[model samples]
Target: MKETAYLLQAALISAWWVGLASNGVFFAAFQFDAIPSTAFWAFFAPDVILIAALSTVRAYKQNSAIELVILGAFAYASLYCVNATVLTASGYLPTGLMLLGLAYNGFLCFSDSAFRVSSTSMTWNAIKTLIQTVCIWTMALVIVPYVILDAFDTFALPSMDIWLIIGGLLFACFSLLGLTSAFFMVRDGAGTPLPLDQTNHLVVSGPYHYVRNPMAISGIGQGLAVAIIFQSVPLLIYTALGVLIWQLVVRPIEERDMTRRFGESYVQYCRHVSCWIPTFGRRGT
Candidate 1:
């Protein structure tokens, strides 16, 4: 369901906020939007609107689209303005949250009804997934670092591009892997990766031939690469958290879903190829 993304985003962002507040700067000094200020209330009101938009938003509905555009467009813009001029230190928090929220919205825009719907043309699947990929990559690779750089003034890395080069190379490789997996899912499986429109058939081709989850592997690797490139401990922790979530929470649900959907075929496939880890001598490719 599209609500899943919003709910997940809200939870992740809230955790991020709590971590920052409890660890280093509990509402850093020199803030322009401190409590009891009209400026604070102004930005706060927009945040509420942003939250409300996420709550009420639905996918593929013209009215929902219009509402999101009107409310989300202005609310995000207003928050940007405030972040630019007023908020200084912790200000970057809003920027990062907004960008991530925008990334989620990109997914919300393309997928149809919350639950799995009828199959769509491969073209539509490609388009929607492309938008989602671009938004997610931009937010994670670009926007997240920028926000961290700004907010974490004291958190400095070496003034060298060594890590950047390494991270960039690793990110590129995994991104290619992810894209290749998506392509196979679309071409062979006849669907997009969005839960709202999952693959119609079991996709055991291309990267899936070797690994059960090239995308998950790619995502984890890319996340680690980003953290390494930036020399960011926080990002490293984030990568670890991602791994735990995938292994503990997401993987179980997804595996159960796959079993329910595909039955014996999926179980047999799992028996052959390992999930992410390469079992080269397995019976099936």
Candidate 2:
């Protein structure tokens, strides 16, 4: 029998597939213009091979190594393709698909293993987290912003040089905070920040002591910084939308998971720590 976690992952992948297809069709037919048919197929075509391979492994194999190999190849090709078309109108589609596809593929890999967070070595966890961070940053800060705001020549502020300097400074500071927090997670907690390989221990020694989610706080700040640097209203709104998603949707679920895993210890910590604002004098117990 599959673990509940793995089951949820599978369900989520299925739902994503259905939702994207249905919504695309609906919007195209009744509400708004849709992406080109070829662009849409380009996004989903590779997944056909991937799904078949992963299903094969699930049925007869003991591990997902072969599936992982194929995914790696596809992901590598996707990186090159992303670079080539990043400035194009429909480029966001493939870029977004790459992120979601890797996540779904990882879910399939977890299906084969009796999975648990922090089961891998700290080194592997750190490596995975770093790579994931770079990919997401490339998408959010570089690719998507250029495609959405820059390529289309969106409205930009006049005094952007000064704003750029300030935003760059803020980005560096928040990035340092995020990296430092990740290092603490790896060294002290024996895991990474990503859910697939989260810390085994409750990490409260560094930034976690001041806030329950320093990484999240840093991430939102970094997004805001990017928006400021770009001086694009659309980018600012995009970052704000992401903040809203994290706060309203992701935070509650994450807190529940932490409480479930860490029990009274987490509950007690939550009492002292704020989720968004960092406290200076007191630390979580």
Candidate 3:
């Protein structure tokens, strides 16, 4: 039975790669206006392949409940890709591409198997993290600026000044760095950033060697970058407030949690590493 399952899974994986490749070709053809309007069938092929592959892999690997949830997400992503392709055909190409990009991000954030979380516990934890992300973004980007600062009244896009362009480039670089840090946490520490799924190992390498809170710095840096690009005083204030909140509220709580979890090792780390600033020559525990 296991051999049969493995063979079936291998076939499904092969088919999925083929479908994905075909989708890429179709997209290229569409870009050059070489494909007809009825090319939606090409999108469906990949969608079906993704679904079949996920199902077969789940069965062959004996996926736990959390694993099943992850598989479900991939299935949803495949469906969303097909929907996006249809929307592209309908002339909303940018929106379609954005949706596809979001799906890809979701896949990156949730599909990994590094975190040692059980199925029952992970469901609620994942949902909580999702809600927290939405709330934080809404408050920082929308509520603080539009409602409190009334930034929309004086809204204008950023001019293509050299400084603004520099800010934009820095924003991209920092954003990528932050994502790499998170990926390292998962790969090295076997955990997600959420408290509910915190790492088993103490991660002292990579970005952690430079600073205590690279992710937080990245978050604040992104806000500053946006403010700089827009040249909005209100957005700048928003970024400042975000930093203050992190310092006054979040840092303390996280420190207490880490100390409790890691004890003497974490204390030594705190002593060596600066909280917000990068210390280049310092060795982290």
The best candidate by TM-score is: 1
For 1-285, candidate 2 gives per-residue lDDT tens digits of 212233333344455556567775322321112345565456455544454334444445545566566457457656744664554434454455455556555654553342346754876877877887898778767777675564344635536488889999999999999888888888888888765556788888888889878888788889889888877665776677677556654565566667778899999898988887888989338
Task: Write down the lDDT that model 3 would get.
Answer: 0.58
RMSD of each: 7.4, 8.6, 16.6
Q: Which ten residues in a row have the lowest lDDT in candidate 3?
A: 25-34
lDDT of 1 by residue, 1-285 (tens): 444444554456456545534664534421334433344436544444455444444323335655366346645654665566454444665554455456446545543333373275888878878887898778766676666655655356545688888888998999899899889988988887655568888999888888898888988899888788778776787678678656654565667677888899999999898896966555563
- Poorly placed runs, candidate 3 (over 4 Å): 1-152
Rank candidates by lDDT, best first. Answer: 1, 2, 3
Q: List the residue pairs that clash in candidate 2.
A: none
lDDT (10s digit) by residue, model 3, range 253-277? 5676678778999999989999888
| Rank by TM-score (best first) | 1, 2, 3
* Superior candidate under lDDT, 1 versus 3: 1
lDDT of each: 0.66, 0.65, 0.58
Candidate 1 stretches greater than 4 Å from native:
1-22, 25-32, 36-120, 154-160
lDDT of 2 at 10: 38
